[model samples]
Target: MSIESGMIRWKNRVALVTGASVGIGEAICTSLVSHGMTVIGCARSKDKIDMLSNDLSKKGLSGRLIAYKCDVSNDKNIDDMFEWIAKNHGGVDVMVNNAGFSCKDTLLEITGDKMRDMLNVNVVGLVLCTSKAVKSMLTRGVDDGHIFNLNSMSGHRLTGILNFYAATKFAVTALTEGFRRELVENSKIRITAISPGLVETEFLARAFEDKDMAQSVFARCESVIKPQDIADILLFSLSSPPNIQIHDVLVRPCGEKI
Candidate 1:
């Protein structure tokens, strides 16, 4: 089936994306807006989202992008954002839990506050978002709603230095499966875990605290996935026939070893 036909059900529907200011999150916002969805793109940096919205406006796409400022790590912020979404758009039909945080500090070097920061964003925040979205879907009688969690390859296997960050993603991996089990017999609500490796994004710079180092690492790689690539996979999963639940997707750039 054509993408248009596949996404017909989603046209003009309300969708919420966390961390929508940058990287895979930004690309997903662009893709969804182009596909004719009313996308609420939330990030701590609302200005960036507005800039993206402005850029997208010139395209005359079928859908629209709304900028929202939200720090997913904060419960009040998340609640406020969801409340606004519920009031303005009548609850979301799609939820993308794409916000994430990581630091280069290894287990030995990481502090309690830093560890909590990662858990708050990477695990707790994601869980809260998922719960809220599921509630919205259940209340609105929207059985076919979808949720996307931007997981990582690190979630599945241990990355030597980034082990703690990987641990949080590991929680996500288990949550994805556990969530699927909960929704199976009762609802058509779909949850997808997208695990990607070595994507060219601001992630590495943030993780390593050095843009040059991140660039050098990327230069060493033969190829790397683009943010748009992840967005495409998202659309692909969404467009699939409803019966086929795309449980998990593991993607890596060509020849990316470990």
Candidate 2:
């Protein structure tokens, strides 16, 4: 089916995306906005999102983009952003838990503080955001709302030096199923986990703490996934029939080995 036909149900709907200042999150926001959805892009750096909003405005999109400042690790920030969204947009019909981070240090070399920070943003923050989204859906009586969690290939298999980061994503993998089982019984909310391998995004630079290294890693591969590629996957999942629930999607570049 065509995108317009499949996603007609989501036209003019509201969507909230975390870590939306750049990369995959930003791409998702752009795609949804182009599809006539009111998209709220939340990130720690509000300026970046604001810039993105301006850019999207210049495109003359059918929908609109709103930038909101939020630190996913902080409960107050998450709560405040959600409150503003609720007041301004009514409630969210789609929630994308895309905010996450990874430190370069190994498990033994990593400091407790760093590991805790990773867990806070990747696992706890995601869970809390999901909770708020669920509550909003329940209160607003939105039974068909969908939630997408941005997981990683590391979540499914062990990767050297990224073991700790993998653990956090594994929690996300489990949480996806946990949420589906818990919420689907009472509501039609759909939960999906998207695991992509070697996406060319700021995540690599942040994880390596070296732009050159990040570039080199992608250069070695003949083809690497792009943020837009993942965004397209998200759109496909969101456009599925109400009876079709896409539980998990693992996408890797054709040239990627692991």
Candidate 3:
């Protein structure tokens, strides 16, 4: 399919991306903006997103990037963010739930508070954002709106080191399908779950205290996916014709055993 030609329909439209300060989220924001779509990049730390916005603005692309401060773990923050979007720039046509992380603790050692925080961000936050985005599309009679959930390979299988995090992703897998089934009855809105393995990101360093060790783990891998790779996949999915609904996409680096 001609991704560029398909994206003509989305030119000047708005797309909201959570956890947009870095890694895959940041790459997605950049790709969307490059495709002539106004992108809202939201993160808990708005400074980085603001910096990115400035950089993109200087490029003078057809699209623009808006930096938004949002803590997806907090319901109030999420509600306020959506409200502001509605009031200022109309509702979102694309929703990307990419804000997710694993705690430093293993399942056996994780505290209740830490577990709750992970669930709030990974599961609850994603659900709430999807609901609001879909509602916005339906209220505005937007049949071609899309929703993307950033899942993981762990969602489809078990990983000993990240058991708890994998559980959350499994929830995402089910949610993506559930959303598609529910929305297909009333609208043509599409939902896609992107499951990726071993992307070069801060996720591992953050998950483990030792940054060097994280780097070493990636070094051992034959290949590691880049953030831009995932961004490209998302663009391809988004650029599909309205008649085509690209569902679940499971991607892994070449030679990745698991």
Candidate 4:
């Protein structure tokens, strides 16, 4: 590779990706390692994390793959995960807050339990991870840090179904913008949000046990997006030059409409 092109590779940078046990988060972790970045993957599933760590070790392509079992909803676990990373990896330069949950429910018909779970996982999880990550960022004395939150297409112009999920994602987008402004003013932290249309992963399986409703959401779009597609975009956001800060990214397969 030419020097110009090689300079763009994230071979030495350190990054933390949450919700990396499966789906887009896993794809992002895999791609980051391939590009030479030291990727720290966090997920609540110990089994999946162990499998990924071992799998990547066999590939011999992984530079530094540290998989940690973390429950983002828990305060102690979140702090411990960040503390471990800081002790071993010298804090992260980029953090991807991809930990979230999805379940279909109408806004009016949504149960108290469902709403609380959604808020705890999606909104609360983001805030908790960001708080912990910011601590490491401050301790490392990193003048510049980047954060990316996985918002959804629903966060933008919500003109379709998935009302319950839409509300949570809108919260994400709002929180991202709010944090972006605050971080920019108070610190050198940069924030970006990505809203993906439809992705083909086990996310649907885990999210929707109901075959009928899952199929309904699946039918809204034509072709399902591959995890790699979102992963590539994520890498781009993280690897972009200092002056070029990506505010937001909208990724969708063809035929996906409002």
Show pairs that collide, candidate 3. none
Looking at model 3, report the run of 10 residues with the lowest lDDT sum.
103-112
Q: What TM-score does candidate 1 reach?
A: 0.98
| Candidate 4 Cα errors over 4 Å, as ranges | 1-9, 211-221
Q: What is the lDDT of candidate 1?
A: 0.94
lDDT of 1 by residue, 17-53 (tens): 9999999999999999999999999988899999999
Best candidate according to lDDT = 3
TM-score of 2: 0.98
For model 2, give the 10-residue run with minimal summed lDDT.
Answer: 1-10
lDDT of 2: 0.92
lDDT of 2 at 22: 90
lDDT of 2 by residue, 165-243 (tens): 9999999999999999999779999999999999999998998889999999889998999999999999999998888
Better structure of 3 and 4 per lDDT: 3
- The per-model lDDT (C-alpha) reads 0.94, 0.92, 0.94, 0.79
lDDT of 4: 0.79
The candidate, 2 or 3, that scores higher on lDDT is: 3
Q: Can you write out model 4's per-residue Cα lDDT over 109-189, one digit (the tens) per residue?
A: 779989888888788889888867776787778757788899988888776556777888999989998888878766777
